[model samples]
Target chain A: MYDHKTRILYVEDSLADINLFKEFIDDKVELTVVSDGQSAKSYLHRLKQTKSHFPNLIILDINLPEISGFELLNLIKKEQRLKFIPTVMFSSSDNQRDIKDAFSQAANGYVVKPGDLGDYSRAIETFMNYWVYTCKLPQEQ
Target chain B: MLSKVSTFKTVLENLSDGISIIDKEGKHVWINKAMATITGFTKEELLKSSPPHIYWPEEELDTIMKALGETMEGKFRNFELIFVRKSGVRFPVLVNPSPIENDEGEVQYFVATVKDLTEVRRVQHELDDLAYNYRVLHDNTSELICRHELDGRYKSVSPSSIRITGYRPDELIGRDPYEFIKEDHLEQVRQNLHEQALAGNDLIRTQYEAKRKDGTIIWLDTITKTLLDENQKPTELVTISREITELKSLQTKLEENNRELKRSNMELENFAYIASHDLKEPLRTIDNYVQLFEMRYSHVLDDKARQYFEFIKSSAKHSIQLTEDLLNYSRLNSSEFPYKEVDMNEVLENVCSQLQSRIAKSQAKLVYDKNMPSLVGSHILLSRLFINLIANSIKFKSEEKPLIRIAVKETINAWQFSVSDNGVGIPKKSRKEVFEIFRRLRTTDDEKGSGMGLTICKRIVEKHQGEIWIEANEPKGSTFKFTISKHLKESTNV
Candidate 1:
């Protein structure tokens, strides 16, 4: 019944937040979770080396154990094979400085994590509706 | 003829000054009775003594001999000498010697007259001391003392003028005193000096800018008095000037530094607004998650787990409220908001309407004047101030019904406002502490607040260059009084 589900690479440190996102966005998309920027980088590197299919989108958190979301976005944008993939910043920070920095670094989208569970679920559902179903994303080479 | 000579001798003896005659070889040939008293020797002993053996002190012997030689050459000479007496006492003497020449230019007796000068020398020494003191005072004082003619020309300047103006006394002596005055201050100084001269007896003290030799401007404070002549007419102007350039510049620098410090403080307040705003996001997340947990698992969770979840939810909610209030407090200092003309009556009506349910529940009797004037301030901030005060009155009501009275009086350059509430009054000591951020006098569960309302009100009042303070009301309760200026002196822009 889950035929051709959209794939997403979620880079986050908090297990509770990851579990919450998974429960909210359950069967709508196939999710790959990495706790840190380094692991996310290594996972992307393995995908490229194996000539495996790239994820449909990348969701990056700003604060991480190793490399930050900004550095990861820069790395992704620099790679010839990964530059076309859409990257969205997912963070709890709603600071103007953070928002401006995310946009200036070529992040395709930025979303603040909602405080309530219902709102968080609704925000994810809206993001999926627009990015996954309504809009046409570039096909993986 | 013999009696005539005797009468002449008697007349000479009665003279006050000593009188004697010396020969060309410096021998005492004759002397009167006064000479005998002055020399402390008899007239016979003086006549018998020779030049080297006479009463002349050793230091005066050469001067006496020189005068004797000069007199022998037919030239009259006057010399000062110290003479010793037979009793070893010394006195000052002025001696005049002249040659007596006979017929055919042949020199006869060389006659000399000696006068005691002890009293004359004492009077002359006193005059010399006074002149020396005047000279020292003129040259040694740090103040630039100057004597100027009535036409403003410099008659003389003290030695310190060279240190202050970089010009010697001679260089400035004949120049017009106005030449050294800065061009911008020349007219004012001229007018002041002229007025002081006209006033005659009135001394004038004033400050003016002057130019040094290198063309740098300096400020000088001068006290000027007119020097009057014998007829009491103004003759010269005497000015004592002290340099105050350093003090003037220091005052200007202090003002500049104050402005700079105020700007830096504004920037810091803006930073606080940004920081507190950003802090609210995470707090909201934590609060929501805890609420979600409690709502979804209340039936299945154990009593202790439920209590923990409740504590987490409450703490998160408290933090969110605190951060939000902190943002409001800092925003009061933010210059991003513009000040406009706001009517206080309208603002008060709006506040009453917003708190209508609370007022009705608490049975608050709100009173205010219908005719309130318009003031210059932020409309949002002023309305917020009223809302906070009125809401506080309702929240902190005592056993009796709440009565909140808002009044305004027009003061000079400002409108004075007071909001009096008949409520559980703030304690005398905590009246000041209540205005501090996060400081609440009442910590009971019923009186809930983030404790930033009064702080925000105070900041808003201060931003308008006004003051806000609390005082005890009549009979009971607390009254908050503040002022808002009608006129804004500076641009309230970021």
Candidate 2:
């Protein structure tokens, strides 16, 4: 039932929110969580240099120190090597304008952070089932 | 003598003026060919007649006899009188009478030259009428009609100058037009006048600030045209001007109000955005952490403790919902979405799919017409409207399965839509207040709503230049009806 767990990069600032996500993502994927946008950029740069350890999915939080989720999405879409990896915006905002902006900046999906723990677990399960287990990705070379 | 007489006859026949000779006894002795033609009579008929001849109209007999008596006394005078032709047509003639003397120095015959004045009088009457009409127009019109010299002096001014510029026509005439213009606009006005003179008949129009005679400034919109002479050279400039001070001030005031309104609207949108993001973030965190704490320590937490956690989590969640609903309501104050051709059926389908879980949980039966018309609107807003209405029905359902129906009616200028549900109907007292923000009729803890659904719906409908209201559905239900204008314009800054 387990070959290689699908690799994912989660960009967030709040430790509690990341822990909350970690509780739901348990044993489902090789998850790498970064605290801020600066660390996320450096991690992506290392993956590009090594030609390995490239995640299959990247989830970004909108409000972060130094840079925003939309800016990182823009940078990722512009890079030839990092462009193919699927990206999603996970935020506490349910603003329609923000959702529209995320999609316009080439984010694959926008998911709002649910307040209830049960609802958040269900949302994470559905996101993992569809983006990780179902969708196919380009071979990392 | 006979040869001299014949020579004189030839000269008189060629004269354009009618020549006639009358004797002292007021009888026609002889007349020239022109006289016969002018009177429209044969020479034989005129010569054979006496004082009261066939040419005399009976109405002028007294005047004619008085003039004839004066001519007989050698008091010669040129008098204009009416003469009748043989065909009974009367015309005006100028008679020049002179007494001819014999060798005994006595007056002999009255020789008169009659000149027809019909064409002259006709032209004089036409000129008189034209002058009268021109004077009436120049005096009565409200526009300041002025004729200016090539150098910008007023050659002539209409009587309306007194009303428009507080100056009489005599006061304005021969005055330089720049004298009335404000100093700041004087250069521009002079430049415009120069350009207009060079542009010929292109009809240059300009608006400028000018001082009235009472030392008050007014706005003048003047159209200047170059009046050309026969050789196409511009002889004078004619300007037709009217005061536009009131219109200018109104436009300025309206612009200022619009600017103020725009500033306040932007501030409101900024406030809503800040509240939605900053305020809701902490509330969401509180709810999530509270739930996580309960899940981790369920054994240690007794029933009372667990109920306390429930209250905290619920309050936080309600706060988050309230913030979200308030943001949505404020966002509708400004049109952030552009209108496009949206299919109503598709919008409803999307809305139903969004509320699939809620519908399944409540076992609600949803029905609607398949042939909904396409219209111009914001698709996202319209979908939210339907979703809110349907969710509201499910939230307030009675002791039976909920039944909701969406219907549309085509109006002359709009598409009227109604969403009806067999739910616990709102009482008559609360029906009108339901559309107000935060006006919740039910305070039940289980019903998780922000009470802004109908308010947002009403705002959305109004943004499309439409209206919304609530009506009691027959046999126990509530129906929310609204209209969307057929020709909705895109992006009005409501």
Candidate 3:
């Protein structure tokens, strides 16, 4: 039996947050990290221009330095080629307004960043277990 | 008989009033002794004079001639004139002249009497001066002063009525006072006036809306009183009204500003909640990476290097806790929590079980009321309050085993609860400081706390319209007392 690794594009501003994500998933999945929304948008635009394969999932932070995560989400959803990719809003805010706005914009999921290290690791693990193993996704072109 | 006649003449001479008789041709025919004495002329000097033409002043000569002509026709009774004395001094006098007719009723001589009026004229002048002063004050004042008959008709109104009601004093007089009252306020005004009339001289103050002559409505604060007659019966109503339109509008504006301030404060609190929540993410990330580093490099790292990692991890964790506490505090302003009746016994049981490990380690004994009263509040927040207080008792334990006793009692309007602990009691001086956010009395490393537990408890209690305080427990312990109102109402913005 052969298994393929899942590819995820994680957009976050803080380096420590990026390190935290890398530590949790280890080598189980192929993770690509960008520090801001502008980099993530440019990278996606380059892949589309080159006809490269899209990632299996996109994790976005709501507060970003340039071109907020909301604006980037709208950009991705507006594009027919990239709209099929599942996007999850991973933010520190459990605010009702933020959650409502995310769901109203067709986000697949919203996860609050847990404060405890063990809880944070467990949350990411559960998310990976379901999205990468249990759930089905459209095959990348 | 001769003696009797002499005595009557003496009486006539001694009279204070002067008496005189004038003929039909306006001549002084007969003058008594009193008349000569009053005019500063001798009796012989008055009889020889021509009469009023010589005795009266030139300004009044025409009036005296008119009186003599009327007297000849038997028309004059009593008339007044200004008489000139022998010294040419003028004084006021009352004159009475009547015709003395012959047998065929033809006019003959005229009998006349004169009386001095100096004292009477002096008092009359004083009364006129007082009336003039009163009129000036009444017209110049800003207040609308009015006198109304028992039937509500305006008897008199001051000139200030024009400035207040846009109606001239003459126009308002004799008009019904209720005519100026706004249509909706007519009935209330009538009722108030009627009640005040029956109150018998007691001044009643009230406010109502009235229409000006220009048809603009204004607020009027009026003080009304009833004037009584000699029989103590209500005869008229006197009212002094002042326009209060500006004051009324200002009051409404102040109320609107207060409501606006409260709404903005709530918005600011919501912003604080979101900001603190966002800040926690970075702190958590720092903590997670530090832990990962320690786990991966503990073997190759020196002791000092490992200790540095521990310090970083600890500081990051503490910062995360502070942010979480701030979020919790601000969340109390949210109106999403619905109030319900919570059973205290169940809440206390759950809190103890949650802290079972700590209690087991410290060997603490927990005592509580068998039948705890249920209170109306948010169950989640109430549970959090008890958990913080109970956990605090376990954390701040003494050398002896911790003895925690929870008691509940019924008060006049609320349920009073006391949680007593046989732990190290708080000092009296720092008792109030402990409730402040991030204020810790015990700074030692062993007794570690976020120092936000009591502040959160205070916010929760205040949200429910209750109060919390601390007291010294007997025999070396501390007691935490709090109250919960029995009635459950909607939460207010605090």
Could you say which candidate leads in DockQ? 2
Report lDDT (CA) for all predictions: 0.82, 0.87, 0.82
lDDT of 3 at A51: 85
Determine which window of 10 residues in candidate 1 chain B has minimal summed lDDT. B485-494
lDDT of 3 at B488: 74
List residue ranges in candidate 2 displaced over 4 A: A1-8, A27-31, A43-57, A70-87, A94-110, A126-136, B1-164, B169-211, B214-216, B220-247, B333-336, B352-371, B393-412, B419-433, B471-479, B490-494
Clashing pairs in 2: none
lDDT by residue (A1-141, candidate 2, tens digit) is: 458778999999998888889888867589999988999999999988887778878999999999888889999989988887889999988777799899988888889999778889998888877777787777743
Give per-candidate clash totals: 0, 0, 0
Tens-digit lDDT track of model 1 for B177-286: 78889898888887886566656945687789999998888899888889887998988888889998998899899999999998898788878887887787667657
Model 2 fnat? 0.74
* TM-scores of all candidate predictions against the true structure: 0.53, 0.60, 0.58
Residues B1-494, candidate 3: write the lDDT tens digits. Answer: 57986796677567788877766666677677779867888877777777455677888888887877777767878888888888999989998876778899887888777888877899998998889888887988888899988888889999998889999999999998788888888888777765766667367777889999999988998888888889999888888888899988998899999899988988888788878877877677677777777778889988998888778877887888788888888887776566877888888888888888888888999999879987778877888888888888877777789999999889888888888998889989877877898877674575566798998888888877778998998897789998888877644642
Residues B375-487 of candidate 2: C-alpha lDDT, one tens digit per residue: 99999899988998899988888888999999999999999999999999989888888989887877567786889998888888988889988899989889999999998
Docking quality class, candidate 2:
medium
For candidate 1, list the clashing residue pairs, or say none: none
**Model 3, runs deviating above 4 Å:** A38-54, A70-86, A100-108, A136-141, B1-275, B296-313, B336-376, B407-413, B443-446, B486-494
Query: Chain A TM-score, candidate 1?
Result: 0.92
